[model samples]
Target: MTDQTPLRSGGRAARRAARAKALPDHMRPIRPGMEGGTYKPLTEAGVEAIHRAALTALEEIGLADAPETGVAYLTEAGAVQGDDGRIRFPSALVEDALARANRAVTLFARDPAHDLELSGTRVHYGTAGAAVHLVDVEDNSYRECGVQDLHDAARITDTLDNIHFLQRPMVCRDIPDNREMDLNSIYACCAGTMKHVGVSFTDPDFVANGLELLHMIAGGEDKWRERPFVSNSNCFVVPPMKFATESCRVMEECIKGGMPVLLLSAGMAGATAPSTVAGAIVQAVAECLAGLVYVDAVKPGHPTIFGTWPFGLDLRSGAMTGGSGEQALLTAGCAQMHHFYGLPGGAAGGIADAKMPDMQAGWEQMCSNVMAGLAGLNMVYEAAGMHASLLGFCHESLILGDDLIGQALRCVRGIEVNDETLALDQMREVCLGGPGHYLGTEQTLSRMETDHVYPRLGNRSSPKEWDELGKPELVRNATAKKEEILAQRSRARFDAETDRAIRARFNIHLPA
Candidate 1:
C-alpha cells in the first residue's frame, strides 16, 4: 500500500496481499477501433467524409417537414420543399446551423438541480436502454423486475463513486404499479441513497417525481433555478429525418422549465435513415437540431446538450445496435457538430450486443466508450451496462462502466507539456553520462501516485507466480469488488422519519 507502488510485491499469493487495491475493470480493457476485435469503425477520413455527407444531407438529402410546426423552423432557416413536400435542408442552411451553435455549454437541471460539467473530463457516465427487459439474459429467460434488483443496482452505483448517475433498469413489469409508479420506486431508491443521478427521461408523471426529488435535494425552487435538473429529450425520427411529437413535448418541458436536456435522435441508415452512413448522420443531426430549434424557439439559449446514436442498418435484424462502427462514427461526428455550435455534445458508452456478458460485451463497451473520448464529447448518455441496447443491466457491466468512465476521463486529460512531464532536465542529466535512475527519483515517486494505472484484476506477477496464486477471471475479481463495496461503511444517510415517510408514500418497506 505504499504511495510509490499500486500493485503488491509478492502477487496475490503474498500473505499481506489484499486485492482491494486494483483499479476497476472498465479502465483495463481498451484497444483502438477494433484493431483487435471483430468489430471495425469508420476511419478518421471516414468521419471527415461523413461530416461532408452530413452537410450534403442538408443540401442534397434535405429534410422533409413532417407537418410538425416545431420541426418546420429548420425549413424556414434554409431547407426547401421538394416535390414530395418534404422540407430539404440546403448545404448553406446546414452549415449555418452548425456555425450558429455554441461549442460547449453546461446543462442545468431546474427541479432536481444539477450542472453537468463537460470539459476537461469529456465523458460523463449514466444508465442506458429503455423499455422493458423481458429477457433476464444474465439468469436466463424473462423474469419480473422486483424491488430488490432496483435497490441493489442503486446501492451498487452509490457505493461506486465513479458511476456518474444511477438510471432505472427497464423491468418486464412495472406493476399496478403503473410504469410511472415503477419508475418512481426506482428513482426514490436512487435519490434516497445516491448522491448523483442521470435522471430517468420520458413519462410526464415520472418527470414530475424527478422534479420533486431534485427540489428536495436542492432545497428550493431558487436553487433549482440557478442550477437546472437535466434529462434527455429523445426524438424518434421517420426516415430521411422527421421529428416525433413526444420528442418535441419533452424538449419544451425541460427547456422552458430551464432543465438541461440531451436531444437524441437515433435513425438506422438504409432504414430510418438514407441508404449511406453519411446520409444517416445527416438525417439524425437534422432530427436532433430540430429538437434544439424547439428549445431555442420557445426560449432562446435554453440550456441544451446535443447528442445522437444513429447507426447503419444491419439489414439482417431490424434492431438498433449500439456497437456498430457507424454508431461510433456518428457519436464522434455529432461531438464535432455540437462543438461546432459551441454546445456540449452528448455521447454514449458501455454498450454491448451480447445477450449476456461475454467477449462481445467487453469489446462493444470498450470501442463505443473510446469513440466518445477521442471525439472530445461533452457528455455520454448511455455511459454504462448497455446490453441489447440497454435491455438488461449486468452487475458486472455496471462495475465495468465505472472503470470505463475513469479511462475516458483519463483520455481527455491531454498530455500535459509541463516541465516535469517533458523531462527535459532528466534527459540532459542522462546525456551527461551519469547514471540517471528515474525509478528512485523523488519526482518519479511523486508522479507515480497519479501517473500510473493500477489494475483491479490484471495480474502483474510473472506467469509462474500467477499460476501459483491461482488464475482468476475478471468476473470473479468484480464479484469480490462488489462484496467489498457492500461490506464497507457508507456515510450516505437520510433522516429516519423522512425515510419512513418516503417508504410509506411509495408502499415500500426497508429493513431496519
Candidate 2:
C-alpha cells in the first residue's frame, strides 16, 4: 500500500497539470451562442397577448416626433401620418415589415473568429452602459469615467472567456466635444478588443467621420461594407411612443452606410413608460416594431437588432432598479417577444445596483444574468461591471462577472441526458464490483474538461486549504487579475501603420 501511494499522488498531480492547460475553443464547456430557452417567464398565450397589444398600440396610439427622413421612410413604407403628425401603422404594414425584417443576423468582429451569430435560442453576453462614473472599490468612491478607463475595460474584456463582446461601456468625460467624444469612443473600443463593438452617435453629423475611421481600419469602404464589425446602438425612440429625432437620423445614416443597427428603446417604468411590467413590455415592443419598419423602409432586410430595453424603476424613490427581480422578468419577457417575431434581439442584464463588488453585487448580478441566459436572449448587454443602476462601472466587478457568467452559461447549457451522459454503465461499475466510487475513474478523467466549467478566479478550496493559501478575498483576487491583464501588452491594438494613419486622420485621445 505504501509503495502504491507515490504512484497515486503522481497520477493526481498529472491530472492537475492536464486540467491547468487551456482547452481549444471546441472543447471548452461554455462558449458564445449556446442555446438556452429553458426558463420561460411568459407563457405562449402571454407572448401572443403582448404581441397583439404592441400591434394595437402602433395602429391606434401611433408614434410621434420622427425625423423628416424617418417620416418619409415610414410614409413610403405604408404608414400614414395622422393630422397630429404621429405616424400610424396599419396592422398589415406592421406585418409586412416583420416579414421583410432580417431573421438571422451576424454581428461581425474585427477578427472573424469572434463574430457572433444571432438566431434562434443562441445566447451571447457582453458589456454595455453609458456609465458616467467609475466605482473605485479601494477608495469606496466614484469618479468620472474617461476614455482611458474605457480602453482599459475593453482590454480586460478581451481576455475574459465568458464576455463574448465589448460594447462602449462608459462615456469619455475627458473629451469635452461631443464629436470628439464620439470618435474617441469608437477608437478606444476598436483598439481595445477584437470582439464586435457597439457604439452610439450623439449627432448624425459625426457618423460620416466615424465611418471614415472604420473605413481606414477595414482597409477601405468596400471592405467595411463587406464585413462591418461595429454596430450602431441607436436609441431611435425617446420613450412611450416618440421618436428621438437625432437618433432616428443617425439610424438612417448607419443603415445607409451598411452598418448594423440596434433599434434601442429604453423606457423606464413609472417614468417614461407605464408602471406595469406587461404595459412596459407592450410600449417597448411597439416602439421597436416601429423602428423595425423604419429600418426595413430604408433598406429591405437590413441587419437590425430588436433592442427592447425597458428598465425597472423604484417607484418609491423614482430611481432605476436595474438589478431587481422585476427587471429580470422584463428582460426575459422581451426576449420571448423577440423569439416570437423571429428577429434577433438584445436587452439589459447582469446589472448590480450595489455601489461595490460585494455580496450584494454578487447576488444581484447572478440573478439577472442567470435569468437572461436561461431565457436565451440573443444578446445580453450590460452583462457585466455595471453598478448603481447603470450609473457606475467597476473593473473588479467586471472581472468577477466573467466567472459569474461562466456559471450562468453552464446553467444555460443545462443537462444532457443522452446515453453517454447518463452513464449507466459507469454507475453500475461503481455500485457493483468496482471501487464503489466514481472518483479517479476513466470516465471522470475523460469528461472533466468537456462537462465542467472551472472558474479562473472563483475559490472552491476547503476552509483549511483556503486559510493556508492566505484566505484570498474575491475582489482582491479580481483586482490582481485586472492588473495582470492590463499589464500585458494589448494584442487587440492595430498595427503600427494603421494606428499611425488613424492618429493622423483623427484627434485620437488614447495614448500611444
What TM-score quantifies how close candidate 2 is to the native fold? 0.98
- lDDT for every model? 0.57, 0.93
Tens-place lDDT per residue, model 1, 382-423, is 667667766666666677667665665555544558888898
Candidate 2 residue runs with Cα over 4 Å from true position: 2-10
User: How much lDDT does candidate 2 score?
Assistant: 0.93
Model 1 backbone overlap count: 24
- CA RMSD for every model? 6.7, 1.2
The all-Cα superposition gives candidate 2 an RMSD in Å to the true structure of 1.2
Residue-wise lDDT of candidate 2 within 323-397, one digit each (tens)? 999999999999989999999999999999999998888898999899989999999999999999999999999
Clashing pairs in 2: none
